[model samples]
Target chain A: MDATQLIHPLLALALAPLMAGIVNKTKSAFAGRNGPPVLQPYRDLWRLLHKGAVYSRTTSWILRAGPIVSLAAVVTALAMLPFGGTAAPLSFAGDLIVFAYLFGLVRFLMVAAALDTGSSFEGMGASREVTFSALAEPALLLALAALARMAGSPSLSGLLAGAVANPAVSIPVLLLAAAAVGIVLLAENARIPVDDPNTHLELTMIHEVMILDTSGPDLAFAGYAALLKQWAFAALLVGVLVPWRTGVLWADVALALAAMAAVAVGIGVVESTMARLRLVRVPQLLLAAVACAALAVVLVLR
Target chain B: MDFWVNCLVVLIAMTNLRLLGSSRVVSCVHTVAFQGVLLGVLAIVGASGGLAAHGIVLAAVNIVLKGLVFPWLLMRALRETHLRREVEPAIGFGASMLLGVLLIGICLWIGSRLPLPVGVQASPLLVPAALFTLMVGLFMIVARRKALTQVVGYLSIENGITAFGLGFALKEALLVELGILLDAFMAVFVMGIIIFHISREFDHIDAGELSALKD
Candidate 1:
């Protein structure tokens, strides 16, 4: 077993929550408040794991299984991602489809879990999540398709690794793809300008309201899964924006780690600068992203 | 030089689509002006010689007219009208964007198939970008509801013609190129005057409603 192969997964598992911590700390700095420590996410996860879970009699087994299954899907998806110079643990031809669909599965379970709670608010969140994600999915797939065409590779590993090697593709295409993926990253992770993760107001919330029924280890799993999902998407974003390979494993890994941290801070900057978009206007923003990615696609295809 | 030309071409195409997808009239105006400036810069970059005298002159005039002067003139015309967006369009934003994409694809195909003129300095992507811009401009003119937006569309069409002139046509005749610029200046001035009349005659500037009037 190569040491490099283990680097991506281990780093993701250990540092996922740290991303959340960094994001909060950045936001707090922007807001002029001394926020929680950078390790707060880890502490929260630990506390949640230690507490006992309490479920209402009204819920079914789906509620219990939702977080675990979603976490499982995220882990599998993470394994398929190549970070910096470290190759993915499991990458095959057309693994991009599996990577994309595993998130779909996670979404399916999360929505199902939300619906199972019988809370109208969770249902609302579920619907909003589905609607926005439905708009966002084409942009994601189309952007990936653009990358696939440029690289002429169907899998995530080959696509990210070899896409830029093609002299035919230019910086504009990559910049546009990066922009599309950045928007999708923000949208999928329930960040600002799409959905606000920190809002407690039930009417405006999307991701948080859905998880209102979760507690204890289940909540911890969901939170951890979220962090991993963030890490995975951040990895994908880094892969698109920065594909620098030094041929030295440690150097490349360090660069990837730095890129991941930069993505967190970037997210924080975005959240601080822009207000959450109106629900009705969110599709327009996503459509603009689609236009951007589609332009890149056209450029690549041409 | 090639990368800069390619980026400019791509950016011009993007600005055309931005005009299509945008809702607000002012932003659309800004977008077309931005496209105009890009077209000017594209002309300068697409020129073979390094900052030739005519190239500098053409770029300066093009940028001044399209970027600064046209925007100021349009904003002056737009100030009297309370309208800020294209609220009721024949085509919605999403449909317009998709159509713009389809237009680019078709134009790219057509552009690749068409032969580039012999010994002319033009990027392979330039002709298609010009075609795409032209098509989007025409679409905007027809589909948009407001008069100000239609004017933006018209300027976009002229920008397309200007791009084509810089790339595929008028390699020698700076006179003809200047004539084209002067023609657009007059056309915009005339159109602005007409828009003023139309807005004064009617309470709202929705051009589609004008079809109801009979001479």
Candidate 2:
């Protein structure tokens, strides 16, 4: 892989934090408040990395390794993602499966660390996370697998590149897959309608509660990983929605980056306009996503 | 033409979801009314010849009765009953919507298997959309405890039938369509009176409560 292939990772690492900032800015605009500078997330990460690490007496090596493993898993997954139809450096058949489970590995570690804390609160959060992700996993896998079939590719790079290569047949599949992945994105990242990243109330929290014990550089790793995960999901969304592939490497890369920004803005707008669904009702939204994806599969087969 | 109809199909499917998800009485009424207006638009567009006079009259009357008259009657019952909103039971909004999705799949499967009328120009999605709407409407009637929502469900079932008819454009008789509308009006009008009395008798309009009655 050359510099052209490296562009996806370079752009993502540079802009992932900004995606969070953009979400904050849009939400701030909706709330009629001037939010923090768009550079706040970068500043927060820097401050976090410089702080001292703290560990609970009950915690083991599992807790110490949680953030590192999770972040490492996310970065590995990123290696397989294409930028604006540009293939990943590590593209292969069935790499999409590996890509998906790498995040699952992240969740597993996070939940394991949470359990090792021996705190009932984090356990409740982990249980809830597992329950919801259980439902979300099927929809995400179904949507991705169906998209792969529609695009006639078993890998992420070719599946997305195939979509960009042939818009006519792949668009309907993209439309449905996009909806499914969109919900997965929100749910996985702990966004407003799924789990409010902003909420501090322990009773209502899903993801935040799991990370309550982390401190210092570990928290920063966890925080940055969350941002990167958002970027990855947004990239997947942009892959489906923006099928433009100007053959110029720079132009396609630039256009995909711009589309990713648009998606961040869209997420912010959705977060601003809608209140979170009740915990009972979130499954319905995910199910709706499954239906949309299933309908696409039906359309493809029909 | 197929594109516009498919877009309409999407909109109709949305209304079905909205009705399934929304528990507020006024919003449900509005969704049912919107489906009527959509049907009117569907009638004109689904017409074979460019803006036939027969199609225009049918669309106008269909809109006036289904969109205007039926919802107005339901709202009046709503006002008399003083039922602003309701809590759902047996199924949550998510499960209801999931069922709605499953219903769409079933309808798509059924629509695919059922042969179309010879030489009809209906879009491929139209029959499935109509069938899906009908299934949701019926599901709403069975699942919801509120009397008004059940009425909304019943009206949507009518909307589904109207959509199915438009799919064929078998307008050999205009009077038969009007007769069906008149029958629906009578049903809603009578149901409205019954709802008002039920509300006065029990201080609530949950149809499920009627099951508690003793002879």
Candidate 3:
């Protein structure tokens, strides 16, 4: 692997938590409260890292392993992802499908861990996550497949690089993908409109309640991993939007960073402006993503 | 590898028969677990031909995750549930088995009709095995009332798909193979959790009891 490939996973690890922090700060500002510092999550991670975890009495090793496995899986996925049009360390045909499935692996672990706690509320959240993701996956694949068809390349790097040549198609497809991904971000990250990350009420919570019993570094890992996932999604969005040119690395890098920030801000705005959807309504939101992505595929094929 | 694949086909057929002929949850789980091990062996055999480091690693993952870990987890669940037999089946055993046979016949008929692509000699048995596995999985899901049994059925269907994938696409992309394996593992894991929860809340693992949320 080249230097760029080696750096991608480290870069993902470093930048992910910041995206979460930025969203939290943005939401705080919108709510007229003095928001936690943008580095609050970092501090939280540090504190959690130094402390001892309190395991739930009802939980098994699966609960303890959830965050570790989740972080490892996402990091592995990041290793497989390209940055700024560079090939990942493990590029192969249909690697994008692996990328999708790796995320599924993490989701599966998260849900299982939640269930291990034996909380009905957590179970409810787990159910929602699974059901919505099953619907969301086809959209994710259909969009990627559209890009794959357009580029005649199934690798994520090739699809991103080749598809950008046609701005008319790429932009709309990216927009649609971004919309779908945005919903996924909210749903997966337990953000507002699909879940209330900050809610104190256990019954209504999704992601937070699932982790209610976890403490110390395990919580830190889970929280940090969630941030990394958002960053990865944002990076993927950036890859779709910014075209890579030889000797234009600076421009590409700047655009990618800016796009990440924009995504963070956009997520914040959504969280600030919207209320959590009713449980039933969340599926409709995800379905809208599926619909948009499917349309994008049809359009690209046409 | 060919031998392993044939063994998988046989296991798939047995699992289908169990799903069709028995109303017992424990029996179904045991059959599916047996199939999972067959899939692991098939993975190893499939990978053995290439002799690449990637293939070796993938084969190891297949054995550990699919063969050993998953079955062990299912057995743990089975022990906890203490419910050995499926009390009632959605479809009668004889009828489902008859349908399964018809589906296999259809698969063979379809496989024989498709023309081979250039440079490729398609296997006559592969398509039929896959289709039969698919049909059996769907039948298991529809014919069984218990949530756990449905999951076992789903895994069997995935096994069939995995077998077909190995036959056709395994040589095409290692990534795809790994992806499918990972997805199937995660899917079963998720399904297991859901089943556990359903049993906890409803006092039983029946799929019909999960209808409380419907509009």
Between candidates 1 and 2, the TM-score winner: 1
Q: Put down candidate 2 lDDT per residue, B1-215, tens digits, no spaces.
A: 65566666767876887788775788889999999899889888778768778788879988999889998899888887888576454577777877877787888889989998698888777899899888888988998888888888899898898888888776574676777778888999999999998899899988888999999
TM-score of 2: 0.91
Candidate 1 chain A, run of 10 with poorest lDDT: A162-171
CA shift of B22, model 2, Å: 4.1
In model 1, the Cα lDDT at residue A271 comes to 97
Which runs in model 2 stand beyond 4 Å of their true positions? A162-173, B21-23, B40-73, B91-95, B170-179, B211-215
Q: What is the interface RMSD of candidate 1, in Å?
A: 2.0
Pairs of colliding residues, candidate 1: none
**Cα RMSDs, all models:** 2.1, 2.8, 19.6
Return whichever of 1 and 2 wins on lDDT. 1
Give the docking tier of candidate 3: incorrect
Ranked by TM-score, the better of candidates 2 and 3 is: 2
> What's the true lDDT of residue A218 in model 2?
96
Best by lDDT: 1
Clashes of each: 0, 1, 4
| Candidate 1 local lDDT, A1-302, one digit each (tens) | 67788889999999999999999999999999999999999999999999999998999999999999999999999999988888899989989889988999999999999999999999999999999989888888888888888878899988888345644356778878888899889999999999998899999999999899999999999989989998998999899898768888888889989999999999999999999988987887888788888888988877
User: What number of backbone clashes does candidate 1 have, counting pairs of residues 3 or more apart or in separate chains?
Assistant: 0
The better candidate by DockQ, 1 or 2, is: 1
